[model samples]
Target: MTAASIVDPMFISGASVWPLVEGGKGVAASNGTSAGAWAAAGGVGTISGVNADLIDDNGEYVPLIYKGRDRKARHEELVEYSTKGAISQARIAHELRQGEGRIHLNVLWEMGGCERVLTGVLEGAKGLIHGVTCGAGMPYRLAEICARHEVHYYPIISSARAFRALWKRTYHKFGDWLGAVVYEDPWRAGGHNGLSNAESPDQPENPFPRVLELRKMMREMGLDQIPIVMAGGVWHLKEWMNWIGNKELGPIAFQFGTRPLLTQESPIPQAWKERLLGVAPGEVALHQFSPTGFYSSAVRNSFLNELYERSERQVAYSDDPSDADGRTVFLPYGRSNHGVYLTPADHARATAWMVEGFTQPMRTPDGTLIFVAPDRARQIRRDQADCMGCLSHCRFSAWKDRDNYATGHQPDPRSFCIQKTLQDIAHGRGDPIDNQLMFSGHNAYRFGQDPFYKGGFIPTVKQLVQRILTGE
Candidate 1:
């Protein structure tokens, strides 16, 4: 169960991936330096989560800059930014690679212009990128798209069944070109998760059988040689050695998401790293994101606390005449108007808090209004106008689609703009308890259980690779 026992050879498209990969994180958590460090170590490193054009002086990611008056014009700006970001990321990968490792790009399928943005980046960085990894949705055309560009592709899936669904539809045609398959644990991963309502968030199933089934499916589809990269909640080699030499699983590799957040080369704020040190097992929870309609994981901080409170207080509306309406409601402080609704003692307490300026107003993505703050509310509206229209039918947009379809009841107050929050966090304006929406694996609490990670040592990419490889 030591690191030496876990080290194994992993191959993708004739390239060797030292049995370890640094999973791609969004908003610049896994950037060139982090990915390069992994590549430098003879493993695969994925640069992801809206990569910045770090080549610009001042270390500021240039693509995030807003310009243009309309969505079309703004989208052009985004293309330019993404191109530069891709080049910058590729250059960093090449520099750190020393010509001995594999480097890949990770893109979320749900992101605005997913295919276009990724294509622009990949086209710009021709020889620099070895592969492309995508998750969050079933990328039905991924194999076709990558094949057209002659690039390798890896789809992140949670179960063997999902992979089978994809293979039957698209990847089956690409055959050997499909580089690797990533299985990220739904119950335990940072960022947007892949769980459905049918799956229980609290329960985690053994990954061994799931991986074996996926390998079997791949074999049946004539892809037995493709490696399976395990992601989410993977911290140490000793915990994973049991899967290394299993015959049913075949060639297996591991991908680390949250563990990489504490690396010196990682671009996360220092305070974020410090917070991970104090995390206990079960401290991380999987909840539905009001923004993207997907499950995501993160430490339960003030931001989450506020969201949870809102959910608890949410009341279902009924059109039946028996239902109470127009009841005396106390509005939160800074709300332009009070006396919205009140039925119970808790409603009275809410009204009291509002009168005392103890509460803020927030709007959901569905256009339902809840009081958050006058200042915060104003900021949300102002930030919404700057929207490059990154998402299709943004809930913030009171603007409708071209078909006169009322982008129906848009302008949700419950969800804040993801771009704004992520941008703020990336720029170091993040507060672990308030501003930043931190994402981690469900197993993040396991850090407290281990002695080696006591006090949350932020290791360098080199140190992480060495430790995982050596099993120290």
Candidate 2:
């Protein structure tokens, strides 16, 4: 894909930089090195503040090792770790940026103790980060927090409606610090998507109309000067030539989230980079199995396949014998041999599964039992026990940050421990890469199809940015 279209420099975060943004990825995929390199290349670089990594004074990587006895204590530990990691990464990015471009911190609003982590990092690393881009939820307090820190705020929204709610509720008062509006296409973006209940997962809307709506809303709110960062599925600039200088979508920029993963500056492991080139079209799909309760797109590897199969082996059971189907067949689950009511067909299925080594029937929050192998069941229970409160409220573990520290429901076995799997994949830990979660944008398939990336050639951050500028 080629075009003669040119992208002009845009003013963002008190600086004039290329209208190219490095979309932030989580679990150490996009870190200080990558963000700094991207900023040095004249683009707005983003450091993912989600469970970022840290380096000790000796310049050695310090592993995240939790020492808490309980989930609450570990949750506190995670907050501290995130705060320190963000500060450390910001300092690195600030130093490597050479006083050019902008360094923005990206965070998920659904992360555990998000406010505490953000405030703590800002307090510790003052003046290091020029802006903050947040999404994964309605972060109504983000604008005020950024204003207090004298940094710009970029709210990542999937629709104009979400941006309007934020502006009216909180951002309007701190309009001075509202740097940009990141329109992350929930249908095409990687990691956690921001699709609202009104949107359909199977139907992907054209981004042009959605962004136009957001720009119109901003214009009505006297925010026409604000730029809209188009993130997700942005592979070639030529594909977006029409949107470059479109008046209806004022002050636009493209954020390359998936395209940057294969760059030399990317913090992802070499194997992960290689794996990206092998992704085929239709392999990545938006699924609602995340513990955060948000839909995310990922490759259908063995890890995801297991989750898919786990959900398939489910059967709803009634604890009360007076169910509408009457006193039905019994399913003896758990070590106590407690019996639950199951319909005749479901009973047959459960019996077949039990015979086929799925002897463990774990209860879900939705009053259904999902059968799994005994070892798998134990792993699920262990992961639940080892939860560190990664999210504000994790449906998988029934761990909520407020009230009784639980979601008032049984822990679900359908979802795996995201923290553990992400950390494992990021650090190239013991698990095989296929058994861990690997995030990728819907356009990851193009990496293999594109000739520039042929023969395993990976370009530097500057090279990648320059190539994108060529409308390739």
Candidate 3:
């Protein structure tokens, strides 16, 4: 390794490029324009293959509109739409890179019709996408798909055990196509996190030990030269000097998720970019509100506050009016007056919330009731009704993509429709930066503190890459 290892280029995905990687953000955040510019800057650029956008004749993004009449039909339409968009984005990225750097596609394993979309994109955009990085589920078929397409596969995992399990179960058969293992620190990363049941979201563990463990396990598996991309909470390369030349870990790389959001090539709206500049410490939160049932990090705003408040205003319930404790009170259910019983103390709390205008009590799959304002309840119902089946199984709408097209449970009022909000925010519909779901890394406050972004100045992708290479 060179003394100036931070600026040294490392080979990745059949190309010699900087170890810096752009982690893909979905719903039009990191698109072809941004990914291509990063690739042009001589780094691995990842395009969000999840719900990519298409351009119209005027060189503007075409609004995603569904023509299907029902959830299942709409899901099929979504799959077809995503394939075309992915192909278009891949071509654009390939053109912009000019064959200088590799362009990787990022897709979620649990996204609706993952297999069909991957098949269509890889077949439709042959030789354009060099690799595919997948997370959010086991994705046992990812290696097989990438192998068939003649592309590399990178699996994003939180721990060494997860990677070991994946390799033993299926990836071992396609080891030749294994690109690298992305060790994304679940507590600090933006978007959907990979935190397991044993990990506490409040107590973030040191990523150094985790990455070291992963590298140790990889070496034992005869994968010493395979690069490990350290993601999440990584701000400056200078702060990570020890990891570069350490003998314990070989061929290390870095991935940036939130730092690139302020670049000119980023596809997110101007309002969203501006919002990042003013973010303060503790403004971003790691919460579990996604319909996919994964812990995600997002900026704290009215949108997130509403969800937090709903969970706070919740109480357990029972069907029997007379409980064994003999201190039960009943709350009517949508004119049925069904004996939904609650303890006396809980009843008092619910009555107080009702008097405060939280009259609507919605039942969740967990057998708990969340009290929300009537307007909010109606909006939730409306959003649930407009489900497009973007996820394989959504708790918000209880719409499953396969089988009977339902999760065999009622729509969860505790969750919100992620598809609608992500699309709306990306389209800048009504400038919903604060009103819609906004994902960000926990280190977002660095944008406000870093002198590099002083005076609300936004840099181009190339300039940002150069700045990062300087270890700042």
TM-scores across all candidates? 0.87, 0.97, 0.97
* lDDT by residue (tens digit), candidate 2, 278-343: 999998889988999899999889999999999999988898765686538887776587889999
Q: How many Å off is the CA of 248 in candidate 3? A: 0.4
**Tens-digit lDDT track of model 1 for 222-274:** 77777899988787777776787877888888888877777789878777777
- For model 1, the stretches where C-alpha displacement exceeds 4 angstroms are 1-5, 49-51, 57-63, 317-369, 393-409, 430-434, 446-449, 454-456
What does the lDDT read for residue 322 in candidate 2? 50
RMSD of each: 3.8, 1.8, 1.4
Order of all candidates by TM-score, from best down to worst? Answer: 3, 2, 1
Provide the overall lDDT of each model, using Cα atoms, as 2-decimal numbers.
0.72, 0.90, 0.90
Regions of model 2 farther than 4 Å from truth: 1-5, 322-327, 335-337
Worst 10 residues of 2 by lDDT: 1-10
Against the hidden true structure, what lDDT does model 1 obtain? 0.72
Number of backbone clashes in candidate 2: 0
* Better lDDT candidate (1, 3): 3
TM-score, cand. 1:
0.87
Give the range of the ten consecutive residues with the poorest summed lDDT in model 1: 314-323
